[model samples]
Target: MESEINKSPKASAFTLIVAFVCVALVGLALVPLLPVKLNPSRTLPGFTVRFSMPGTSARVVEMTATSKLEAMLARVKGIRGIYSTSGNGWGSISVNLDKHVDAAVARFEASTIIRQTWPELPDGVSYPYIQMQSPGQGSQSPFMTFTINAPATPVLIQRYAEEHIKTRLAQLSGIYKINLSGATPMEWRLEYDSEQLRTLGISTDDIREAVRLHYQKEFMGTYDVEQGASDRQWIRLALVPESESRDFDAGRIQVKMKDGRMIGLNELVKVSRVEEQPQSYYRINGLNSVYLSVVAEETANQLALSKEVKAYMDGIRSQLPAGYEIHTGYDATEFIREELNRIYLRTGVTVAILLLFVLLITFSPEYLFLIVVSLSVNIAIAVIFYYAFGLEMQLYSLAGITVSLNLVIDNTIVMSDHYLRCGNRKVFMSVLAATLTTIGALVIIFFLDEKIRLNLQDFAAVVIINLGVSLLVALFFVPSLIDKIGLERRKRISPSKPKLKL
Candidate 1:
């Protein structure tokens, strides 16, 4: 191949151009389709179980919710450890799996176990929030935060957020979760005089029963009538009362006394709207506020997602009531973009230094151009490999690209220098030896089972692919250019014969 290329330098140059054009075509096509993310968490095999039972004590939560969940999760396959948290009104369990476990399979198994144990939980506990999560990347952090500052009560803000803001935000694409803080959930409050209740022979339990009887929906089977021989229909029947009131304070409830006298609930208790105890308190710049923390999906572009969210918020701001304003806060994408910018700046500086050093050594424009071409081709090809493998571009992967840049430049400089000294015949052999030695050291990283290696395989993969491309460019493309451009022949100064002594 070398001799043939040496015989027809133009053919070699054409081959190199065609090869790079093919790489460029692939790179351009795949670049837009590649998934972009701020940061990618290295997920391990694990699952989390969350349970909430309002008004329950920690002891009850532990014995009834946590213990039963742990017992069920223990039966899951590849169980390495079980850790749980039992708190007032809530319980959580984390089941860790062996390193060899498949995350998806573990999730399925854990979900099955949760389904089996869900029925065993005591009455009053809400359905358990069961999910699979990686220990390393358990859940993504909030992508953006905004504070709703309004001249309104906490209950009012909570209602508005739930009814208006939350509903709007949930409609946006790529949003995973929207967490509200400093706003209390709506709950019915009943304040009663102890003496009045005692005189009426009524308890809080009686009042609760009355409310449940009025509010609870009941299924009453169906009412069916035959309309025609081929068309008989049944109307579903439900115990829905048209006169039921939504406002708790509007009308009086009736309670039958033990002695057959009836009393109005208004005479016994006062119903009012109030904040729940341990209410969430959110304040920004010393103003009453409700904080919204928006988390984005794992595969989303944090920067682009934030922009879309900002635009939506802006569009809706004019519709807000007087004295209500939305204050944008802590955008996580800024940090991610900042980190990327730093990497880019460092890479630019490294390239500048490499170019300056090469100029000082070779002082030839042709050699400089060849070096740039070789480096660009190899790095571009490396990027194609990154997207081809379904890897999300992240901090570690960017770092790998930075390192790959230096390796490609190194290979280019060495082979270019070798060609300027020796002929093209020796350039390929020398570059092959150097490239093989560098690649051999990285081969072990792909096989290691250590945590760091698992987290860094994308980095190693980038490096290896770039190295391989660098070898191709150094062995073929660079040599072909040097021979075709006739830049490999360094001008030799023939010693002039000393003038005959005359």
Candidate 2:
């Protein structure tokens, strides 16, 4: 390889330049494809289980549901701690796992334990919902919040938002979750007449039991019937009794009295369907409103997702009914956009400063141009690495790239100077040693705890990749370019001393 290169340095230089140019082109193409976010997404070493038991007190929920779940979850391996909270009619348990444990495996085991313990829970308790608790999930604000205001009732506004706004936004890509609130659900309310109940000698507990039993359906055994006399074929039919209907008719229900008399429930209690009082209220400009909170997927590009959501909302704005309006409650993407703009500005300024410094030091356009090309190729290679590693163009990663710019310039200058002053072998060894030392320090990030590693890994990886690429460019491309441009020969040639005329 050495003899071949010495024989045809131009061909070798051309090949190297073309290869790097192609790499730079490919990296530029991937710029738009990179996923951009405000920060790195990290899954913490924890899992949460939430459950609810309507109409049950917190104490009852703790005793019957939360306690059992915590006890069962504790038996799973790699668990560090189990924390629980019991609220009115609801409960939650958070399980923290050891840093070295595989999150997916731990989640599966925890889920299995929860399912096994489910049957032991009270009948009123709902199924336990398991979810991985990512870092900052509890305090992280929604990506976007939209409020709906109108002249209509809160229920009407909520229904419209649910059917139109929420559903439409959810259909867009990158939407992870949507939550709608600020409206009350409708429920059947029953008012009992004390005098009629006393006269019928029926107690409230009896009425409750009767109502509960009325809704219970019973399934009888299947019956087989002969379809045809000649063929003697039989068809089996399932038997089920229709015990209750969704529509509540007062006369259809009956309460048994202490005197052994059955009376229509309408005589003792009046039933009406009405909207329940709102548990939580939302208001905008002194008017009741409904709002939707949208959360994007962790790996999603926030800028793109935000734009898509806003465009969709604008497209539907005209379709809303008269007096109905959609207002932006809060937009997290605005901050992200501003931060990105700042990063871009800082990057441009940094590149400019580095170029000026290179010119001042080298005073030769050839060296300056070589450094520029090296920087470009180094950055392009780093971008390719980012895409390969599934790293996001976020704050931390961008910061990494920005900080690595200085190092890229440094490597190029060092290699070019040494190559001109010394030769290929010594410069190559020097650059290689420097690059390896920097990488060795960065490799320590991978050995840290998983939580810390996840947060810092992207930064370390970007720096390491940039440095490695810079090394390669400094060793191969820079020297080849120097030989092609004859810069080394120019520097080595000394001006001939003029003959003195005595």
Candidate 3:
């Protein structure tokens, strides 16, 4: 009766083992398919709308332009607070959105409202502007920028960037948007002749009016119908310089002065297509250069994106000037790759040592196989879960997986150690109790842990999964395997005749 008391079921361990292998394989396959990124920038997306009325008073711009745009954007979605800087003839409308709102959506909504309001503004006043809330855009987006400065001509830099670099950099997958900031290459520079106008008895205001007439012939005001809403409309009147090539000289324009004076406006001022550059300068390696910045997209895979970016750069080496070179201010690609590899290597070593220790203690190869199967399956489940949730394989997340190494071995130890000690029915019941107790504790830990944002929580999650699966394997399969296995080392009983002879 005692011999048969150690009742173990049929060979179901093999079936569970097969299921574990299938699950593990599926999970491992899901890793590369996940959207991975190396976003180390702590900065969030935020921008403001900027409009300027150059040479005009700040007060005038504020009262007429700034106030109206502010009121309009205030009606658009996603507005936290509005802060403005009314300097000289420029005003900026800073806006912050709720965390849930996407920045791109915010920009679109703001732009649409501004377009509808453009008709109401004075001719010289610009349309209400909206730009991203970038705190240190130079540092954040580009990681590095080189300003191509030509002593007086900056437009060449702008032209070169537009014609050459901007599009090339945009091809890099990880980069979000590349923007050129410094003085761009210019085509037209029309200067007002101060002295020639004085001789003509025409004030500067007269010349300004002449140029204004060239752009706008008949003012088109908004039309309002009876018992209906007003319609914003613009009726084109004059053909200003349609293209940069069309020079605004005295020969082309007919100027009607404020007084009885009549003159060819071109004769009063010099209107020639001179290379015009912005006043701002860009510097790289202590030399002035054209500045271009590269930003990362939402789903940019940092490691792969960088590798592709470098490849693309290599392909365009002939495109860059002899003195020009690429540099990085915020390349987290190499760092992330290194961290991931480190974790992978560590995991490999830890797993090897762990299996070796477990095998040595059990002196059983079969149990070792079970340990490997359970762990592999456990990790596979976690990876699949992550991919299904659309979670990126970030460094912190990988860190969580690596840190789980120690805990992953716990279930295997419990199951294998108990199986070897299960001499009979009492031993089997005790093993079951031990397994249940360990499982209960793991469940408690799983619910209590909450650092899911980083490596800690991820590690815990994997551990909990691995242990739970291991316990299930132990309960449903390992006991049966133990009973059938180790059959050669059975207990030997002496016959009743042997006791009588003694």
Evaluated with TM-score, which candidate comes out highest?
2
* Pairs that clash in candidate 1: none
2 versus 3: better TM-score goes to: 2
Q: Estimate the overall C-alpha local distance difference test score of candidate 2.
A: 0.74
**Which portions of model 1 show Cα errors greater than 4 Å?**
1-10, 18-22, 25-33, 53-68, 87-89, 99-127, 134-140, 153-182, 186-279, 285-288, 450-453, 483-502
- Give the lowest summed-lDDT range of ten residues in model 2: 217-226
Indicate the TM-score of model 3. 0.55
| Clashes per candidate (backbone, < 3 Å) | 0, 0, 17
lDDT, candidate 2, at 67 = 91
lDDT of 2 by residue, 11-101 (tens): 5777988888898889998887787776676656788888767678889898888998888889889887789999998999988887677
**What TM-score goes with each of the models?**
0.69, 0.72, 0.55
Tens-place lDDT per residue, model 3, 1-502, is 4345355545465565566567768889877666555532323345688765656788888888888888888876766677777777678888866545678888877877876776686655643445575321222444324344433334555666667767777866557776666653334334554455565677644554565556552221111111213432211112221233444455665566557756776666555454322435566556555555566664556666666766765665566665555444456666677877888899999899988987787677866776675566667766777766555566655665676556556654565455555433434345456656655654554455222223234344444454555555555544444444543332211122335553
lDDT (C-alpha, whole model) for all candidates = 0.69, 0.74, 0.56
Clashes of 3: 17
**Candidate 2's error at 271, in angstroms?**
12
Model 3 residue 325 CA deviation (Å) reads: 3.5
* Candidate 1 lDDT by residue in tens digits, 295-314: 88766666678888999899
